[model samples]
Target: MEESLPEALSTERIDGYVDLRSYGAIGDGRTVALIALDGAIDWMPVPSLGSIPVFARLLDGEDGGAIELAPSDPFTVTRRYLPGSNVLETTFTTATGRARITDALVTGVAGRLPWLELARRVDGLEGSVHFRWRVAPGTRFARSSPWVEQTTHGKVIRIDGVTIAVKGSDHGPRGGGPRGLQGSFTTSAESRHLLIVAGTADEPLHLPDAASTDRTIDRTIQNWQLWSSEFSYDGPWADAVQRSALALKLLIYSPTGSIAAAATTSLPESMSGGKNWDYRYAWVRDLAYTVNALIRFGLREETHAAVSWLLTTIKEHGPELHIFYTLDGDTPPEVELLDAPGWRGVGPVAIGNPAKSQLQLGIYGDLFVTMRRYVEAGNLLDAETGRLLASVADRASDAWRQRDSGMWELEELRHYTSSKMGCWMALDSAVALCELGQIPGNSERWKSERDAIRDWIEKHCWSEKRQAWVAWPGAEELDASVLLHAPSGFDRGKRMSTTIDALREELGRGPLLYRYTGAEREEGTFVACAFWMASALACVGRQEEATELLDGLVALGNDVGLYSEMMDADDHSFLGNLPQGLSHLALITAAITIEELSR
Candidate 1:
């Protein structure tokens, strides 16, 4: 028997917008769709996660496209991801009856399909229930207008170069003008129905058969379970860790093996707006954390794929690494503002990320640390990749002295303490790799520079007045990013221990923590930083403190264990993008670290 969700999980919407906390995600490696508790797929980019979205209601309300499916009458809802899979099963109990909707962005037998397919299966549980559903593909965020045409395959929707087909519905395929299709039906006990939305761009659309598509949904569930079973984790918060791993899996782009920072772009980090930025692109820093966590979980295929993708992309596009890359492993394009009224009237829904061009010096450390972790896991680095890493170490040796954006990617250039520490970590990893015969580099220079960076940080970055590592030299602000070095093996002594307490005291609001001092004035507390604090606490031998902190943080996720980029420290509402990869990665690593420390 399926378990029902707790009463706290509400299906209510505020002013036409569902809370970010109420969204669950389904994906097929190429793209992800955000489905609300009310059974509306409010956000989904077609063809790829980075592509223009066909369903944009999450940002633009009714003007944005959405596939709305639910009971026609008032209903209460309960839902959960099918055990060990990303497939979601939502149960709606209306006044008259109950119905179950199983949703998945179906995968092919060989892996991800060449075209996009979203399948939702409705199974009547008890009594008779009336259902209504609409397939309204938005105007691609005002980029292209959609039109319905009658073909031999039935009514198909076309928007620019893309074609869409909806299958399996009773009643006339009523057109909602250029918006798309709608239908209503009634289901009896034990009755089953399937709806498949298949789409393609710059190619012919594949209209799926109802029977085959129904079977494929089961196949996708089985595939997810098989993958999830292979992950080797049995630590505390195991369920949360497993769910996070599954969430992160959806963010990993299988075509080029790049992991997205988050599934959606322009979900605000703050309700008032301007903090919105596109996060569909993969950041090197986030990838490094993901690779480290994947290695810990004993997942080899994804770890190797991610490492290979980053190295190949860097070798082709380097010697200098950009802060982040498109899922196809190219530099991201410039930011474009959409005309859509953002979520809850937050304006300026953006497309491309501007941070791609920013000088985030910390990426050098992110790159080398990823390679080091891979090498330590018994993988051999090819000579070409080794030379590439060696050159990056040489560059970091000098770049440490320059002022630029730190991991936060701020516009103002400053010698951020974390950026300097990142450069130190890069040189440190380069030296270790050299010792392991994994890379041929000037080890002596790397060692010298590594010590020099440590000396510089110790001399200037530490703030005696605050008894912590300041955000930058001579600045009084504290950055939570400095806690990352504890896991990097940079420091586990009194300084780091004290820094942890100081960060919590100065920046923490309950279990959450701002990214840095002054950040609270701008946005909500960062989700990843809270987990980082737990990991840092564990690294510093505060196992009990870390465990308690971890307990609170894990419970903060949505009902299905999905975390966004930020959370309101006061209201506990979700902010920023949904199913944030870095937040999940941090949770995995923190749990693993706590388990290791306990042992």
Candidate 2:
């Protein structure tokens, strides 16, 4: 991965979400664009996925920002992600008939580029429909007035805040060319139209002329189809798996091969008040599972890329490993709240993550889980990587004993049961590496350490009264992450099952599992917990229950198959960040695991 992955918009609740016809998401590996059923860009960020949104009304209505391209009249809408791709097309059916909108962030072949560009095309599908559109740019997290000017080629929106130029296409309206074009036009069933480009790029931007626009769309279709064709797994939920895989890929930052925890952040997990944390960074723990999911789908290249990023992120910063990192494997991003009104008066909409400074030894388990796959696949562990893992093991010997944030990233650090097991995982994988001759380390000491950690977890973390291994030593609460231990090789006995049942009874908000009762505090229900629930169910041989949860989870995707970091249990609205990698990977893992279990 070479640079930051640029992202577009965020999901913000309006006074009422009832009028939204439909919506979809598009992306190049660097950035993503969300399009509404009404043919409006409720949100878009430029250059990199982490960049501030230029059109962010999704979180705050027009006051936030927007780029609208829809019929001026009332219309009903339907939308879907093009099968197996992040390309989303929404069709609005009005009294006159239908108008189709295609949205995509154009990444190069196999998503190997650095810069991001989103392409949107509104083609006339049926009867004539009155169309209106606007592209209003916001500055500095929706706080600036980047200059906009008409050009012969199209329109260029220059950011005084940023050196780059944001270009708009002439394809949308006859007089529209980035100068904020507005007009009423009608199209018949066969009368196709275009709204080619609307994003910022370093180079001279180009809008696809009629012929070229057709080719771009044609190639995009082929790109996704070809990319998705590699999945050979066919099962009851193969379609969903395919979509899940694609969504996962979309969240992956190609330059670094790290998958972000989620796309958009600060959408109320509970409401405007449930904790809303920025989710644009990649967690070492998440990419571990992500690599596995990608490999399961015959996406070895993606797996390798992710491994490379993780390895690189670790190699450069060897003394300590962060729980999370930017997509390009940069040092932990500085967290800051924007100076503007947060979504629906939700104060302090954050931009970066502060937890990066915290110690998270559990990430080593996730790293080993990823690299162990490379070893299993007959790939050689590079010298740097080998030493890095050994050094990590050496460090784990010292650091694993310390109390830091657990998987949930909570404030109070205690002897988290799962964190202890995670230490066991580190040593356990270290022993395996020694046996495989991938790297040479103190296997004997690692084994001893691993066993000690396990013994400690079983004895101290277990709750005889609750009949489950609780959150931490002396803490009576149940932990969802303990459910991750069996897969992490912590414990797979009746104890783990008890924990699962105990969790479902205690923390199950609905069909989905919560991270913990007060983990989010005011946050929405974590979607990743639901996926974790599916996994735990699968582990416990509750195949029927696992399948049921997996099916229920699929229904959580918006009309276009995108997921936010969390979801509102009450209204079922998407909460937290959008297009979360953890959520998608959970879907992928659950889907594949269900298929394997059934087999």
Candidate 3:
């Protein structure tokens, strides 16, 4: 017999800001959730990646919704992912006993289940342990409220046409289950318990049989392990590379084959909190990076899927590509500010990103380079895509001299060195592809424009004072993004080496680096730029320094080998979105560079 208790349970906030590194993430390729060390699911988007978060506690604290499982008594906890997979395992130790919680977003054989399913399995490791579980539903980004409903499937929480059904093996201290699936339960060394929270946007959510969900847990583990095995990279830092590959997989929307820039929104980029922005939408640049990483790992399926999706999306939206788009290939909604106080009291919590309207010249190069890699990987480019590629090359040739936002998406429009470099890369890649007969483009226009871009950059962007390429023409400031161009075949010589040294002297924080030369300190070190610096160092023949920098940057990731967009420069706490795709891509690229240099 089981017992039941009240719907509300007491929860203590873990000290100061719950260090973002302390959270473990799990996803089913559609949506993802962040599980804190205390066993509280603090962040998760329902239905899809771009949807409003159902559990926003990671950003808003107590008033925000959360699904929690923790010992009733004082406990110390430790967590890690199952090797080679995203499934997370956390163990809690108390004065009287200990227990382990295995958490996952269960998947079916086809892919992520059409509905949302978060499964937790608890097994007693020693003595008698008392645990409390609670399912608290909050408004979607505090836009609306969730109400309790008694349905044929039992009791559930309904929010925005979605029904959240919580099913589990144990009840509360009183006999029978709690009315709202909230209660406390006790477990012994011989005991095991299963709990599930499943929902759908419109379908009738049902309470899954516990026995079947147990099987689902095992199958999900197998599925992740199987996917991870298909990736083959025997490179230096193989463990970190594989872990980054797994993290990158979490950003892919399996249903649409689009990759999100990151798993979250509104996590602050700076400690002051004004820098927070949503990163859930798919950016063309991010997808390009994702493809490069996937290809280097010898994983063709995802790369092909992503490239096909990009080509099809461009065909539908015309040859000119937006900076970013929804996972379903539509323009993102207008940016909106949520009413809630942002993470750590940062206000102006935003929903949509306005970057779509910005002219990011770097995307042209990003797309062309990705397609080049796709074709080089022995994949055939369709006729329609070939035309698209040629037209894009022409666009790059015409746009190379124009000033626009660079890769960082800053508001100021100037002759950004990286943007011009990217356009040069665009024409360069197109010329190479045309040489190979993969794209039927007039190589003369591309070659002339490419040469002009190089000459212009060498003359205008170089600074005698900084002894390196500045962020833009006639500026003394350094941008870390220029480091990425070293491997773009522009210059891997003395100038590039001097540029590396300048970036380290100005933007680098040890192994970590800032996006550009700035002292406002509104953001942590940009994770991707650090890795790009490492790769550039290797390209400039500073192999020893490159290896050391790479090792230090890789060590900054959390226990499960996951990285965020930025890290707090003061204490090295992860900031912004978790499992950021660009960060993982940089890691993979740096690892591949080191591996090649070793040979």
Q: Among these predicted structures, which one has the highest lDDT?
A: 1
TM-score of each candidate structure, all chains considered together = 0.98, 0.91, 0.95
- Summarize candidate 3's per-residue lDDT along 1-599 as a digit string, tens digits: 11111122112464223667767789998999988777988887787777787777877775577888899999877677887788998888899998989999998767778889899999999997899888876676667778777776677877887778888887632222332357777878978898789888767655677788888999999999988888778778998998888988989998889999999888888777677788898899989988988887788888988988888888888767899888888888898988777666765578888787999899999999998888888888877778889998998888887889888888889999999999889888899899988888579989999999999999999988888988998888888899889888787998889989888887777778899988436678989989999999899888999999999998888767889999866667788888799999999999898779768
The clash count of every prediction, one per candidate, is 0, 26, 4
Candidate 3, backbone clash total: 4
* Model 2 residue 149 distance off true place after TM-score fit, in angstroms: 2.1
| lDDT tens digits by residue: candidate 2, 285-385 | 88888888777767778888888888887778765787888887887667777765556666567887767787666887887777887788767898767
Deviation (Å) of 353 in candidate 2:
1.1
Looking at candidate 1, the ten consecutive residues that score lowest on lDDT are 1-10
Which prediction has more favorable TM-score, 1 or 2?
Answer: 1
RMSD of 1: 1.3
Q: Would you list the C-alpha lDDT of every candidate in the order shown?
A: 0.90, 0.70, 0.83
- Ranking 1 against 3 by lDDT, winner: 1
Candidate 2 matches the true fold with a TM-score of 0.91
> Which pairs clash inside model 3?
3-172, 3-174, 4-172, 4-174
lDDT of 2: 0.70
